[model samples]
Target: MTKQKGKLGLTARIFIGMVLGFALGLALHGFAPDSSFTASCLTLFQIGGKLFVASLKMLVVPLVFVSLVCGTCSLSDPTKLGRLGVKAIGLYLITTALAITLAITLAVLVKPGIGLELHSDASFKASAAPSLADVITNLVPSNPIQAMAQGNMLQIIVFAVLFGVAIALSGKAGERIAKVFEDFNEVIMKLVTILMNLAPYGVFCLMAKLFADKGLDTLGSLGKYFFLVLGVLAIHAFISYPVLLKLLARLSPLMFLRKMRDTALFAFSTASSNATLPVTLETVTKKLGVNNSIASFTVPLGATINMDGTAIMQGVATVFIAQVYGIDLSLTDYLMVILTATLASVGTAGVPGVGLIMLAMVLNQVHLPVEGIGLIMGVDRLLDMTRTAVNVTGDAMVTLVVAKSEGELDEGRFNDPNAAKAEEEVHLPHGHA
Candidate 1:
């Protein structure tokens, strides 16, 4: 325990790396554009960014597998998994719809779509959305291995719950399986700790590379639209989440936020919720003191389904693209945009380059130019980070809500401002033990 708590935790070091790397990136880009500098800076960028992401990815498969299995078996009654599923999906839908509504409402008032040049010449064809039949069929993978290979969250979830229930019902046989899984969970979690030790170097590189390539000018041109989306996300995160966590969950949002910063920064830098999954899982379980059972099940589902941030982006982008192309969308078109974005949030969420897909769907609905997606892709690298930050926030928020409803949340740790310290006490010594 002394060894565990004596040093700065992985999160603190990684944060320091990110800040230093980001500053170095800006400095290199601004003051040293020469070939040698560029070459040297690229090395720094790769060290901080690529390595961090790769290390994180290394944790993904193990983390998800172990955490999900453990989360599944820990349920008091395996049947409650069904109830948890319902609550999580329901909360996700309500929040997603609310998010888009808020974003669209703000867009209309802000008029972000008005007076933008709508480029018609760029030919961008959108892939057809899968039919409802296909969506349903894809949910239950016949081969679970194939599902994991595909990183299909919904299918992975269905299988994990089923596996756990099977174990729960089998008496002694279930105990044998559960014990094996528990050991595997420990092994995988240890792998996560090993990867975490490399976080500082990875974070430093990723942050530096991002600010170096992505300039403030990207935001300057679309400043209004940017702020509209940003403001909506911020309001939802700071204002909406606090009220819910404080009132409904009866926890201190300030304490939650302080503990959440390390994972939040990782999400902001990586821009992939899936990529951020390992860290998110660790943070929620260890720092926030959410039950591993809840964190494992809810966090992945949240990454896949709780796309309030993406829904908001789709809402604003639909308006922005419509105005850029001089397309005058009526009430029906706006309504369609809302419905389409809300639905697509679930379908296209785990898809890489989801922004393009969502934008494609929105443009097709409003008869805006599909190629308008390219206009935003340059700045999207940064915006992706922001949206991801919101996405994870939604994930943690919903997890807290469901945990509270089930009487699973650790209110004592959650209310303490130094929740991270409590987390170290719970998880750190366990590892050594």
Candidate 2:
């Protein structure tokens, strides 16, 4: 018992940080109100929180590029890459389509927006979505360095895969380069380990600032809309993913969920798929027993393209906003929403404010007033966090399925509760454990 309680593990520490930070934020909002002192304190917290998120972002591009290169180079059969990509991407699109369909069906039945009359003076102007031609053209980077500089994940993935394939096809020279990439991969993962140790403080600051600024009123004002989205997200994460995992991968859903606790918390706190990529990569490969070859490719691509949680929000929010505005969508319009959102998952990859951006596109397609988005924007931050958790969960689920299909999954490591614990001890600095 004493050994168990001797030190706080990463997951427990992070949960405590989140709970304390939320309580602190609520107390400040309720007691301090508009005090200058509260304002100053929150400003400090925001800086610290943003910095921590930035630190994570700094690792994303290099980690994805190098890890991907390493994984690709290690692949002896080049044909496997093509097959793997097809399966991983196909599953992502199917699941996303399913998610939006579920959301729309539930929204139409529940009618969360039927009677509520909401008027917003605020306006939303969506950035122009790229044409299909433009999206396809941009897939192959004109300049790989520029893609990395801009953090264009899809383009980066393309270049890394191609570059790694070239290295794999090359002779002795390729072998040397592959060795260098493997070394880089190891170093970068160690850096991820270091950053994770700081996560408690980062999670604390982020939650504190968010709750301090937004408070509970935002949720209260949009209770129906908020809960509807939350319910759909919960269903997708808990039901949809587990069902697929059990049927397709023959894996234990309970074990998958148990291992996901730490990764899910990271996603919830960050609310950016890109920001969560490093941790997701670590968890899927290290903790979940997915081979790096499969995880390295699927996880990053999933982060770039998969938006199941966002699709759910788009479906429910579209219906909610339409009902609020007294605009009824036809069956055709509903189909269009599903189509538009599913395609937009890929179309809007790497775009900033992706959920709202895709929502704008869907509204335009269905001829709903785009400005209605302003009505629900207030509570989006919270919903974004929840949806992000779902998104990463989907990422892991797909990784498991694909790995299992390819015979890349390690059942022994995956089924062992002590797998990740033992790995962490191995990776720990000398004298730490």
Candidate 3:
């Protein structure tokens, strides 16, 4: 069957691949005990999934640079930029703080990590995180291209805005460059479409391998804690985001969520907000009707710094760790967890093993043993999915908030029920949206 008029849509085909891969993984893990088959299947899944992600990432630099340049240069008033910036950052901070608080509240009320006697012999060595001052200092990149190559979303964004501003000031010459950026944006989005089509299979492979190895028993041991973390994420995704979409942007939350499945799926599979940057921007722009001027800037910054989901993980993990060690944190320690996790959102945004690193900071702040982190890593992938989903949703939320403040968002697109599906139809080879 052709790509068009096929019996099954891309989403359906991907869903099938995911289910089949998962069943195969479970069979290999439990029933078969066939080492060769297991190794071959895992290798196939890894290579295919990695290739799709790499293909998506290949467009990130061009997509972010060009889209951001276009977005910034089009802003005739720099005041709008400042306003939108404040709104986006402010929302992010508030959400991160709220995320941790929700986590703490849930852990206390539900006590998910209580009564667990599992062998928690996991070694945890957390790299020291940068200070807040250091985070600010590092945002100003010495070399813009280096930032882009490094996938430093914050620094790249800072550089893109500056370059865009210079073009905005250059009169006709700047317009020429802006036109080039616009064309680049279109091409990059086409690549995003291509990548999105492969999402179901990618998600399946990632999840199947994750579950097959870890098994449901790992989750059973920390059932309360696991459920608590996941519950908080659900609340944040379903309640927090929808409210913002409705109240601030006058958009339909359902429409946005429906449209976001592909981007969220990509984020869940990759578990890296930076990897999902291109897809997020595309969803916000083409799917959610967010203006590129607002989306390009806000989406990148949000991905880098607005980690509400990760913050929730930190908060819940801190509480769970303390409980496991029989450590009773003082009021001051709880407050410190809130502060540290919120700030760590920005500090460790691009780092690998960020969730673990941020949890270490929280654990230290509350005088809990950092070794407690080992207990949770067994099911980290499951938690990471919920976290990444919240991350992408938070990105979209902040984008809308910024766009509304800038009068840049298109309400018609935000309201359309089909807006989200429209993003998937366009051929995007890079797995962007």
Q: Best lDDT goes to which candidate?
A: 2
Give lDDT for model 3. 0.79
Q: Once superposed on the true structure, which residue ranges of model 1 sit more than 4 Å away at CA?
A: 1-12, 34-36, 121-132, 350-352, 420-433
User: Can you write out model 2's per-residue Cα lDDT over 141-244, one digit (the tens) per residue?
Assistant: 99999999999998999999999999999999999999999999999998888888788899999999988887898876689889989999999999999999
Model 3 misses residue 189 by how many Å? 1.2
When sorted by lDDT, best at the front, the candidate numbers are 2, 3, 1
For model 3, the stretches where C-alpha displacement exceeds 4 angstroms are 1-7, 118-120, 350-352, 420-423, 426-433
Root-mean-square deviation of every model: 3.6, 2.2, 3.1
- Give lDDT: candidate 1, residue 60: 69
Q: Model 1, range 1-433, lDDT digits (tens) per residue?
A: 8786457765677678878977887787777755687767787777657766767766665667667877887787867888889998888887888888888888888888676654656556667765446766888879999888777777887788788777777889888989999898877766666666666777778878777766455776677778888888898888877787888788888877777777788787778888888878777876777888888898988888778788888888877777777667788988888887777777755433576776787777777777887666666677777888888888898898899898887877676666555334234455564
- Looking at model 1, residue 89 earns an lDDT score of 85
Q: Which one wins on TM-score?
A: 2
**TM-scores of the models, in the given order?**
0.90, 0.96, 0.93
lDDT of 3 by residue, 1-433 (tens): 3646454655566667667766776776786455777777777777777776677778777888888899899988987878778888888999899889988888887776678775457787888877789889998999887887787777888889999989999989888888988888887787777677767767677756755565566776667778888889999999988887788767778877877776776787678787788888877887778888888888888888888999988888887887777778777888888988888888767433588887887787777888888888877777886688789888888787777766777888777766656445544357666
How does residue 24 of candidate 3 score in lDDT?
70
- 1 or 3, greater by lDDT: 3
